[model samples]
Target: MQLVTSVNSHSIAVMLLTVLALFLFTREKIPLETSSLFIIVALTVGFTIFPYEYENKELHSIDFFSGFGHEALIAVCALMIAGQGLVRTGALEPVGRVLSKLWASSPKLSLLLTLIVGATLSAFVNNVPIVILLLPILTAVSIKTKTSASKVLMPMGFATLIGGMSTTIGTSTNLLVVSVAVDMGMRDFGMFDFIFPVLIAGSFAIVYLWLVVPYFIKERRAPLMDTSPRVFTAKLMITEESASKDQALNELILKTDGMMKVLRIHRNSNDMYVLPNSKTIIKAEDMLVVEDTPENLKSYEKILDAVLYSSLGAVDEEHPLLEEEQQIAEVIISQGSKLNNTTLSQSRFLQRHNLIALALHRSGKKTETVLKDIAEISLKIGDVLLIQGKNEHILELKQSRELLVLDATSDLTHTKQAPIAFFIMFGIVAVAALGILPIAISATLGVFLMFLTSCINWKDASNALNTQVILIVVASLALGGALLKTGAASYIAHLFVLSMDGMSTTFMLSGLMLLMAIMTNVVSNNAAAVIGTPIAIGIAQQLNLDPEPFVLAVLFGANMSYATPMAYKTNLLVMTAGGYTFGDFLKVGIPLTFIMWITFSWLLPLLYNI
Candidate 1:
């Protein structure tokens, strides 16, 4: 390949910084926020220290931070909040329930239907919540059928990625690519402009996921032994008239067959005791804060004849003064969640949400049995908290994006405002699709309606905005802008064209998609889309061909973030829920990636007659 000697030093430096940012993004040791901040700082300081003048216009340092308020970022955030409102109001839960019924009726038929439904819903709403909605249903199906969850989860996640490639508003990466392309003088793509190709390619992809991918993945058991493996810490109140009022703690242990661990004993408001010996005598009105899984906790309550409660107020629903419907559910802490790295006590979890956390489950890490210790430990992504509360309070928790409610048994029927939420979402898509309003404006207006209609509140809206996504999009924009300004994208494109000088247009398109597919798995898909969109355009310009096919290639390839858990947030979510390894993603994602890549590479050229 011949080198482009005419490329300026600033372009070379920007390219190097981009490479460094990619490195930082892929390193699990470095936090995403830190890497994004580093990249933004480097871009601003580098441009400020040595400003670059192109065509007598100097690129200002302030331009680097402009990405924070970029139109694409606004649209992405607004759409996210809107999607949250749909979930908050239970607008989409009915779909999940219907799908659940289908699964129960015919597991084999439902598997195909699952991929189709998942992909269809994902094309319209945010795919992450779509995965969140289906996750528990699939888990329940897996357990009921005595099948492994590992078989279905990865395929379902990949199916969403397929759907996300269909429309401009389908995925954040798609939005960024289209937004960048518009800024670079290409006609803006409509919401359904690219759907035909994606649907065509995605059909084959979905078939592979439904039929072949399950066999590729090994069957791994979900962490459910005699009930959910998630442990909760509940305080067992020894009532004055209970059967075991004066029983020895050792005797209770003997009765339970040594199955439970008594983490601590609370004698009174003024005194708390550590783990008691086998001979420790249990007294009336003493609070025994025990640590065990939910099933085992209830069993212990039955064995000791004590009432289990999270707060100090009431024992159960039968308490005459406190008559309300109660419920138990499992909620997982999401990545970029406000609850991440904070304790339940520190976050005032109970005081804020009015729900009591009975237990916490961290993947592969046994939580310390002491209630105080468990409360003090910082929560991480994928930590499942077994929580208990009134049905109302538990339903309210679903409004917030921080905690992913995994138990589908909760009554998530549409609220009075659910119809309004669905209408607003439909209106946003309609106006954008009809070209009556740009997506940014349509989505923004939809959010305002969500708040006005009481479908979503201030806290739910705020939590819906993901910090990592905001920062990464901003950083990707900054780098993309710099590349365009310095002609680095053009330089890279010229080199690529020269390297494949003798290759057919079909080979060139395949190569571009393949390159993007690899880069997306190793780095942020948003980054790949933002950066590759411009290069794809440049590659088209170099080849003296229309850029439409090339641009679509970039968009399709960037959304193929299926090869690793770290490639996308949805993948990370399923990793814990399904108990999958890194190899599992590679095993299924690699083939699926090639399937879509080859499909699109051949199909795009034919559609455009390139």
Candidate 2:
């Protein structure tokens, strides 16, 4: 094979376009999908107008669009749906329960376990769902234990990132890197081919996240109030299977450590109500009137295996208060609102709005009486209501001027199908790990089973496919392919080699990884991986060495997306939930970035004996 020593016009054009794309990707003013589409169109038009000639064959314009239907894209989309199945079916809820119990026993040990669990789950599951499952659990834990959420969330999020690097299907970025390497005429890597080096490097990263990172993160208070979050009054109906079904009221209170305050118990079977006392025995079909924050209300529902019922009727198993499509949110009755000064029964709230009124809250108000019927209780201005409905209905309510809706909306879990989803995910991993099929085929099969088993519907599956990620992967593939085909990658590689002339392979590897680490934090990690991979291979070729070690360097470096919140979606999630500032990310991410970079810089050379 021959290399192009001098950069040509085509190479210059591709290089310039790559820079423009990176600029647009990082700009908050422009949407990412729009920028990705623009790159594809620009590449197609540029190549069509001026065809690049190589070995008596012209590079066609249609070739650039091949990434739309690429195998890597198929695998990525399939895996996303599979991950969604896990989330929608609440397959990870059991893990949340275990973590909750662990946190109650010991906070310090819990953080370590949380980091380890987050990392372990991310090694096979997508990082997004792993974080999603743990987010609410940790938030509830923070409130219950009176700790700053900031101390735990950032560390947990970064730990999942470290774990994502350990496997091929751990993240979409890894998939793109491996797929691109295979396309570049390298031997295809197995699922666990590069796991050893990543695991060795990730172990140190995880330890840092568990111990030092939390101390660097400052404590931030919850939103809208400094002393306490808004509290709501809700009724918890105990069913036959509830954990507190036959327990005494005093025992249940002791179990929660007095976190749940029961005002009254209404036994519908006898149409009798009683004030909660130590000797009061809770039976099936009994509704316990409780007061707590919206988060705690939901948390206690899980703890007691009870359902939050509306004032109209007791929610039984047959007609559940929550479904997979429904979501719970908080809305405040504002001035001049339609429901202002009107009782729920008078306003016909549930019928008119297609929403269920689950509970009511008044600032600094507590009732000592039975409060027999909440539906007849007069609503007042500045009162808060806990509501449940579909997403579209919730959005509709948000648009209304009558109520001030809060930013929090939580999805109700569907635990019935959790086992099905777990088995489907397990089958996908097992098949791929055993070399029975390519990951693309195995993951696609798992998605098909998910649909057949009704783990997820078509609408949810389609929603699971991220348009931004799809467009970015497609356009980055086009740009990376263009660079390689036009000798732009080789030209860049040669220049890099000249700059580090007389340096050892170890030093060149370190430099390349550091460059990629910086680039990944500022741009899309997928873009960094796609563009950096070929340059890494080219540099290895220039040095007359195997390309495996250099390619691994690119893979590891591109995953170092820890230094900025904009670098990854999970960071943004934790930022909003933890109320963290940009400086907080820099406070923790910069040192953690260098930690992994330095570790891999030394570790990779030794592992590969470069």
In each prediction, how many residue pairs overlap at the backbone (N, C-alpha, C within less than 3 A)? 3, 0
Error of 1 at 150 (Å): 2.2
Pull out the clashing pairs in model 2: none
Off by over 4 Å in 2: 224-413
Backbone clash total, candidate 2: 0
1-610, model 2: which lDDT tens digit per residue?
2366688899999999999999998997687889999999999999888989876889998998899888889998999889888877878878878887888899899999999899988989888888777776677677666678889989999999998988889888889999998998899888888888778778888888888877767888644223222344568988998989988998877877677888789899989888988889899989899865556767778888898874545444664343345556555553224665688788887667777555565543542121235568887544566666666787666543234454342222445789999999999999998999999999999999999999888876766777788999999999999999899998899999999999988999999999989999999999999999999989988888888888888999999989997888777666655667778888898988898889889988898889
Best by TM-score: 1
C-alpha local distance difference test of each model? 0.82, 0.80
Clashing pairs in 1: 232-358, 232-359, 233-358
Leading candidate by lDDT = 1
Scanning candidate 1 in windows of ten residues, the lowest lDDT window is: 222-231
Predicted structure 1, TM vs. truth = 0.83
Give TM-scores for every candidate, taking all chains together and pairing residue i with residue i. Answer: 0.83, 0.73
